[model samples]
Target: MSALAKQTITEQEFQGFAVTDFPASKRLKVVTLDEATIRAFNDAVSEWTVQGIEYKPFLRFEVADRLDAITNYTLGKFLNATVRDRATGAFLLNYQGSPNVEEGDARTEFEVKLSTAVSHIIGLSNHDAMYGQYYARFTVRNVDDSDSYLRKAHRRMELHNDGTYVNERTDYVLMQKLKEENMQGGDSLMLHLDDWAELDKFYKHPLAKKDIVWGAPKSKNVESKVEHPVFFEEDADGKPLMLYIDQFAEPSNKAEGKYLYEMGESLEADANFLSVPMPVGSMMVMHNHFWLHGRDKFVPHPDLCRELLRQRGHFTE
Candidate 1:
């Protein structure tokens, strides 16, 4: 087994109802909500519909507290710690079975509520400008005419960070798979900045801290351009944190353009990226600055359809 695989959890570690790195990446913990914990959480928050939680923001935190209470406050601590720590700043959260809700739209609504609870437990999710909601739900299919790389199939979406064109401090991102049909490929791709072989190369480059302009396409609903260096800042430990993407950066000079272009090329070429197959009902949350994420291309089918829910937000601390 590879060193990474060796770090994954053994079957024995699955005993607890909380955290385990059963997945290949030690940085990505697989947090399982046992059936009891799920039941307790659902029962406690059963009074609120998804809309109710949305209307009253404080209720979201209450729901999060209830869920954590069911797990003896362990889930909240583990999730916060995992995402806050520089060494391991991501996690995959899912319950063992389908949540208690009607099939179809009702279940999807409950999923959204559950995701909201999880997000609030860690921090507040930023208002998703594209969808005009705290969270965004969109679909991908065999055919798409969107302006951005998002919602397209049959092509690999390069790894990138979120909130690049906004002024918000996007400390974390949550992506949940809602539904899928005739889907092939499209596994989520992630790479820790520390794991990238070219991390130091880019961080040490003279242009590393030079400010670059970033603007979103119309579809993103962002009206203004923002400027920040790709190597935006360092963590408490003084390691590099990145904010880069191929599509949005408007490099002005030849040197800046080439630097960004080469950086994109190097990231795509990097061998350390983890391709995680996220099942429906599973949500992947990661530290925004340290972990870059993207999607693999889908094998086109006339009926191919996939729905995804995303929430990007800042950490509480």
Candidate 2:
């Protein structure tokens, strides 16, 4: 458990939303938008289609402003504060009740817009090479042929930071569950760097600062390789900030290989990580450097299907 107390939020300070600590961890905040807020947000941005916002980047900020306006501009301020603080750099955003919208793709569009709004309020998402857009939407099924474990349903995707193979600074990650069916397990896994007991051991090691090659699989759609150390940088308070992934790190020599391998193992074995189950229409946003995110494996079912939307980018100072 974190030393920080669960943040207390009252309706008096805002409208149509509530904040609480996630039951499993104090490091994450659970933000619930009341139906009234959702209705207002839907009505406010009803004029703009998802494609229009995608095509016109400024409109995305408009969408975010409309939602933040519902709470008298407190939602955006709260969200930004939560994600930037190292002690509480993550949030699970979900509505208290059903959103005022029709079922099917219409609702999916609302979800996408909602995520876009949330993401833009904090920072703009990087161009997702995998999806050829600012955000990536993909599905996982019982059987698949993919170059990475991203779409595989049976095995756990070990906990690691994203943007390890890319040159861009992925300061944050936003993942929303657009839809799912016949799904069991597959909760998101998250770990704060400060919570890992072995963090100091690795961060203080000599190899931690050495440049290591990182690359992506064929499905990632990136042909080039990048170089960076596992602990590539530091936070404001000098805490270690990581950029690493077990599968993508191409260590150059025996020392580099073992260092990377052992770091992955140590991260996987940590006990402080949180397993968060995101309901449909819910999103999880985290500071990419301090928080490592992954997915748990799904149970086998012939008709299992899960669709997810992902946005990763750096903070705009």
Candidate 3:
């Protein structure tokens, strides 16, 4: 439980959506859009296709504005506030009822646009080198030949922050479940820095501020190496903000290697993390620095397939 109170959002806070604490954690807000809001949003952006938004970056913001307008800007205001607040810096957005969109690639396109509106409402998404677009859409299957553990269905991807190896500042991460079939397990794991049991043990260590070399593999399409400590910087409230990933960190010496290994072990062992099961068409947006995220290993099936969309971006001042 966080030091902050579990917030209660009244209808006065917003007209089109309702905000409430996720059953498991007070640090996360679950925003459910009423069917009217969803239908209005769908109609508002029906004119803009995913390709058009991809080709015309300005159009994405326009689409965001349309949705924000339908809620009299309350939805955007609430989402922005949640992302900026240290105590509650994450939200899971889903429609209250089934979205009546067709089932197929068209549905995927609608989800892409919905996530686009969200990413822009808070901030802009960085161009994803892996997908060669603003957002990346990839599928996880029972058998994957990918270089990273991202697509592997058999192993848990360790909890860590994003943008560790990249030069960009990844302020937030937006993940939407586009589709899933014959799937089991693979719930998203989330842990806040304040909730970590051993945060102080690592933060007060001498190597907490020391630089560690970080690099991505060939599949990530990132060639250059970068350097940053695990607890890279402090938030405005003076809390630690991390930049770490188990697979990418290249510790130079024995001491650094041991530190990185122990850190991963601590995070994985920590029981405070939330195992969130994301329903289809639902999207989760979280502050990346203070919140660590990963995926649980999937139960194996011959035709298991889970499609996910990711957009990582820095906060706009």
Candidate 4:
């Protein structure tokens, strides 16, 4: 059994879901909810609409509790433990099979509600200014005119941490695929900080903790700039943690520029990263500080399109 498998409860331990190691990386746990669990969740939350959950904040927590109740609260405990552990801070959650819900919008609503429960189980998501909600849903296509690489297609988005330009602490990030058509490639890219070969060389450098300006593009809906070093803080065990991105970083001098550039170059060249193919209903959540996430480019097809939902926030406990 892999290390993550050891950390996870055995299939017999949890009634609603089964936990295992994702094939691409043992550090990532794969949690699959059985069809019965999905059906129970859908029936439990059927009374609450997505709009109702959005309008009322407390309803979000209620949805989370309903999902946990089905599993006898084992799902929440396992998810929290996985996220809190430095060695295994990420998981890919998908259900066993289709539920009884109709396809199209009904299925999409189920996806949204499911993601909301998962997020709340871990922590509350920060309000996404771009979408004016706690979560944001965006799409990518073959051709686009976007301010940033987020919506752009045909090129690999360099690996980087999220919420680098925002003031709030981003303890975790949740990404879910809502729709896809004629999509080839575009697998989710991930790299654990501990896996980076050059982590120490950069962490011990003088510029590692020096504050640097970070500003987002107009499309991000963030106007003000924030300042923080690549290695901004340390975990409970004193291991280095990071908050950085290649695009939003604005170094003031040659020294800062070179440091930022080398960091990005080193991360991009690292061989320890994992490339994960995300299924439509599956959601991937990771520790934002320790695991860098990105997207691989899609094949150029005029009809290509993919819709994704995202939630970034700090842990309450």
Better by TM-score, candidate 4 or 2: 4
The C-alpha local distance difference test score for the whole of candidate 2 amounts to: 0.90
Better of 1 and 3 by TM-score: 3
Q: Rank the candidate models, highest lDDT first.
A: 4, 2, 3, 1
Worst 10 residues of 2 by lDDT: 1-10
> For model 3, what is the alpha-carbon lDDT of residue 162?
84
Q: List the residue pairs that clash in candidate 4.
A: none
Q: Name the runs in model 4 displaced over 4 angstroms.
A: 1-12
Tell me the lDDT of model 4 at 163. Answer: 93
What shift in Å separates residue 311 of candidate 3 from its native position after superposition?
0.4
* Lowest summed lDDT window (length 10), candidate 3: 1-10
Clashing pairs in 3: none
Candidate 1 per-residue lDDT over residues 1-317, each given as its tens digit: 23343344232243327676845788889888887777677778888888888788899889888887776676776777778777788999888865677789878887887899889999999999999889999999999999989988989999999999999899999999999999999999999999999988889999999999999999999999999999999887788888988899999999999999999999999999999998898899999998999999999899999999999998784
After superposition, the stretches of candidate 1 with alpha carbons farther than 4 Å from their true spots are 1-16
* Per-residue alpha-carbon lDDT of candidate 3 for residues 1-317, written as tens digits (9 for 90 to 100): 12232243233368888888999999899999998988888888888789999999999899888888989888887888788788888999998764567889777877888899889999989988899998998999999999889999999999988888899889999999999999999999999989999999999999999999999989899999999888888976788998899999998999999998999999999999999999999998999987999999999999999999999998774
Best by TM-score: 4
**Model 3 global lDDT (CA atoms, 0 to 1):** 0.89
* Local distance difference test, candidate 1: 0.87
lDDT of 2 by residue, 188-243 (tens): 99999999999889999999999999999989999999998888888777778899
TM-score for all models, in order of appearance: 0.94, 0.95, 0.95, 0.96
